[model samples]
Target chain A: MALNTGNKIPLYQQIKQNLKQRVKMGVYNEGSSLPSLRVLSKEFGVSPGLVQQAIYGLESEGLLAVQHGKGVRVLEKKSSESVAISFGFIQPYVEYMTFEGQIIHYAEKVFDRRNNFMIPKSSEGMASREREIVEHFVQNGVKGIILWPIDNDPNGEFFQNMSHRIPVVLVDRMVDGADLPSVVLDTHEAGCDVARHILGKLNCRRLLVLMDNLVISTNRDLIQGLSEQASEMGRMMDLTVMHLPITDFIQRLNVGDYSQVNMYIELVERQIREGGYDCIFCPQEEFLESVIIEPDMDKKFPELKLASMTGPMLTRSRKYNEFGVIRWVWDFPQMISSAADILQQWVLRRKRPTENVSIQIKQWQSTE
Target chain B: MALNTGNKIPLYQQIKQNLKQRVKMGVYNEGSSLPSLRVLSKEFGVSPGLVQQAIYGLESEGLLAVQHGKGVRVLEKKSSESVAISFGFIQPYVEYMTFEGQIIHYAEKVFDRRNNFMIPKSSEGMASREREIVEHFVQNGVKGIILWPIDNDPNGEFFQNMSHRIPVVLVDRMVDGADLPSVVLDTHEAGCDVARHILGKLNCRRLLVLMDNLVISTNRDLIQGLSEQASEMGRMMDLTVMHLPITDFIQRLNVGDYSQVNMYIELVERQIREGGYDCIFCPQEEFLESVIIEPDMDKKFPELKLASMTGPMLTRSRKYNEFGVIRWVWDFPQMISSAADILQQWVLRRKRPTENVSIQIKQWQSTE
Candidate 1:
């Protein structure tokens, strides 16, 4: 189509648009040189300067590359099309709002302004749905993907197949037997550190650890750490371990499900009465919170000191902090920033690193 | 340059090489379309078919892209330049030979034929040297990197900065606070499983865990798992944990350094006599082997039952098998394949995955 000079749009912009359309239509394919500026100017009934301006505009937009004495060339078709990176997480958006927010914050800072971030709606235990979301991103031209996968994900083969086509960064939990990059907390060490704090620093003679049937690596790591440290302390320490019968309480707690809280309280109370423990440790903040919130439960077990691994929600809560629970805070900002940094390399520079990054654990104790 | 008909090379090949040289010398810049077939044929005094063939050759080599209506265009000036992906690990080549071999095997299968793999010489605790190697790779335009980092890496900041330029996959170990992808064994679960086997199945009443102060996540995970499981089984089990004072002995052992083996044997002998343990758990295969190789140590402590995390080297050993040590085997093929799968996704597709991939632990109990 010919450029209309009488139109309000600038002459250069009109010419640029016309050329862009031709490139999109494959009239001038990628790496295909455009007609010389003189020929274009004569054909468009515009000045040679206007033609030059149009080419320069396209060049600035990354649709065309101008090489001196080599004529203008099409670099890419549909250059202005926004290619967003998609992130898939097992947790629903509302539950992982803080994490989601941090991802966007760091992604914006790292990615080019032209790029955007997309998060598909996902829920716990929806491995099939997670695979579908990933497939959808792959089908579309998503630049990259970040996934916070479900525990014991059954879609390992699907991810392995997808890995052949894109970069996938696992954020929190990882799938066993799926070789994917990840940014995670050193929960095992954190567990050991927490044990050291309780048994070494606090010097409680009798200790009780509360866990659930989630069978996650993090929980295992934490429990293992506490056990090893206690074991190392030998006859000086007496450790009792109890598994919470409440399945998926951590996931439920994230979404504000507290119907099972009473069940947890009763279980903890029974264990305390039987074991006569002086110190109690919960691998997750949600578990600790559930126990402490059981009105008069903390007072009834006044001799018991409590500690747990904290999340952003628990760390920020004034009421939760007031309970005087010792907590381990994960460095979320650093993790997000690190993920962004890795993304910058993979997406922009196209460099694939051969190492996993771990976010260090920060312990938060009541100053009072 | 004029074509030489007398040369042994085909006319089209000669033309392709000449054109390639010209492109390399900047006669035709990237994004610069070449002359029409007719013009090129006329200029070179060659048949139009020969010119067409030469252009197709360049196109196939990714140096040029030829459009149907448009002329041949330079796609990449240095298209034939080989870009190798570099892998850096803290362990020496001979020490981690099987692991290294597995990595290479899987990488070749997953990567494109055009890509090559490079592994620079590295040794344990050489964090500064590792950083320099990474820098060298970046400067050289290495496509991707695989890192088996040292524990408590001092170069976390450097690697994080490098990750902004490329995708990194951490193998076996990870750096805390660096956002990178990884493929690792779930050592924590293995620890728990081993503990269960020993306490429940084998009915070992007393346990001794012998470890070195390498301070790796695997050691911590194993120790934690063992401790937790032992604690859970309580009263029914007695556990003792000891750390060997030897530093880098694990690395040295892998490469066949037995100078410290005598020291280890002496230490174990002292512990066995003092503690009178019936079952001994070595966190690593090397440690187990070191203890078992001490002529008649098993006979000296007749009731001692041994167990360890086995690698390819140890598992294949007839003598090791004869020792009847219960072994936990990491599926190297699966781990490597998973890593390769992750690398393919990150490097080729540029898709960032959001979760970590853990290699499943396989148990190999002695039939005897």
Candidate 2:
């Protein structure tokens, strides 16, 4: 490790150089905890502040990391010798779901990056390109992956043809007829509950269901669930479920603009004016927020109601009770924690995870 | 690598197993791309659908990952990897910030998470925890850290210590004597600009500045900027700044209730009506939203006006815009891109970056 000696380099820089040299000399291996700053300060006969400065300097340099609840451990350095782990994510921003955050955070916490992990960018639309990227990671000797699959069940073959291989844990979305360990929300139940709440308490005769494209299993399952529930309810409910694809919606409303929302409200208003539907059941929070801004609910359709299948934000909102958003809890930490446990067992004992290891999401409906 | 037999275990599962084995054997590496389902299907003489199913299965199993725009890649198997470059965040749960989604999404796109990245969660009141976490990561050999430093530099000594050992990149905030590399939003400019927009154009003389705790540097900079601007304007403008720490405010105003918002409005009303303030400038979006729900500005104030630092939601809200909100554009992607570029240069090239790189923020005054 290079040591900074110039006074302009700061005292901490000088101390950090010594520590780096120790690491280079194999004094500190991955996962080994370092001495406390105070202890080091006393040993070096330097101020604790200087020691701390050194530590922070190393941390900022990516020679060290700081976690909230976990103590400092030697992270595997990303030297030329490090192994790589392949990962794929389907969500637009990977972090869209809080669950994703938990998974990523968990991965970072449990693995040694320098010698054990590698992640490449993954997206849905670029199928061929995604395949190339995956192959590149595999060729370079990636360990395994954690992915949120696309709706299609057949996408799994990409990894099958690879000469090299890796283990995988699915997050959020599920693959049909696949016997891989997976963590997914109970979207079917979530859909049914959303319909039941709107039909039973909100007293809606008709409803419009806004959804994403049905290419993925989640969309198919949600639509199927809602349709089945609606069919069973019969004449008691006149639910006209309108499938508005997000892409089409985006084209009209533009991303991050309210025009699409305004258009949706106008459409809803027209439906209400025509005396068709009594409620709008948005399948997601983005749509739910759209419904919230349309204040004409009291004026145009006095009896019409609105609700959606939403995450924690809906319940956390000040207008939660005012706006009916069905709570759908996805315990990310539990899933990740379990996956880690399973992965560790596999790594340490060479025991494969049994098919029975799966997580089912819990659903709750707010009566109020 | 494990091969699929299209049996009870499912073809996708078989494919996932094959990939997993290859990864473990160091055949597939992190940050490397993988083969597409189509190519894999052709090579294995299986249907494309089967390959897709396998990829999805792998995703569910946490063996493969896909990200938007970047396609599929290998990821680190756990949390203890090396972050080649660390970008500091100034706020807790930056994922919830107006532009944080884009920031993280893009970062995920370019960053090889399998190589390891450090994201330190440092809130204002949690200094001890922050220091401990930083130390742990530093000792682990993290390449760098992306942090949201604590307000008041509560962990100043800790950061100072860490800074001496590793390269730390500060995001969204700047520390006065710490010559660190930072990508920051010009909140000082944001504040002064908002104040000028409202006071100059809206003819708002009396104003109320609602500020929360200085948990992040952005918060403090925003308030400071506004105060500086107000002071510069001198007479004719009556700016009454209401500073409430987040904890104290939450205690006074129950989080779950909207009543607190009403109370704030009533207080502001009293100020405008009795105390003679004509406008209100909330430095943060939460406070801004709270103020927007109050009685109609045109009705209550008539001659009074309102402008605030707001998120994208407020800009999209037609009703909120009728009152006016300073649409502060926090370009998250720019910072992420910058960090990614910096990481590539530092980690991949082994070059020490010069300290202090700042991102400029674009402010949209409510001219409407």
Which candidate number maximizes DockQ? 2
Task: Please compute the TM-score of chain B alone for each predicted structure, in the order given.
Answer: 0.68, 0.61
Question: What is candidate 2's TM-score against the reference?
Answer: 0.64
What TM-scores do the predictions have? Answer: 0.39, 0.64
**Model 2 Cα lDDT, one tens digit per residue, B175-234:** 665666677767778777777777666657677777775566677777777778878888
lDDT per residue, candidate 1, B1-368, as tens digits?
Answer: 24434322366765675576456546678898887888778866799999898888778878999888877778897653332233322232332333443333333334323232332334334777577556544443344567777767766777777765656777777788777778889888887888898887988877888877768787898889888888888833478878875446755554434567777788888888887788888756656665554345887888889877665333222234457777788765566556655754554434455547788787864332
Q: Model 2, A1-368: lDDT tens per residue?
A: 12212112245644765565445435667667777767777766578888877777677767766554565566655431221222333332233333334344444434422223323244534446455555444433333455555545455655443312445556666555545556666667666666676776666777777676656666677767777777777733476666666645533332234456666767767766775776766655555554443454555556656655543333233444455444555555455556554543333222345543444545544433
lDDT of 1 by residue, A62-114 (tens): 88999998888789976733222333223323322234433333333333232
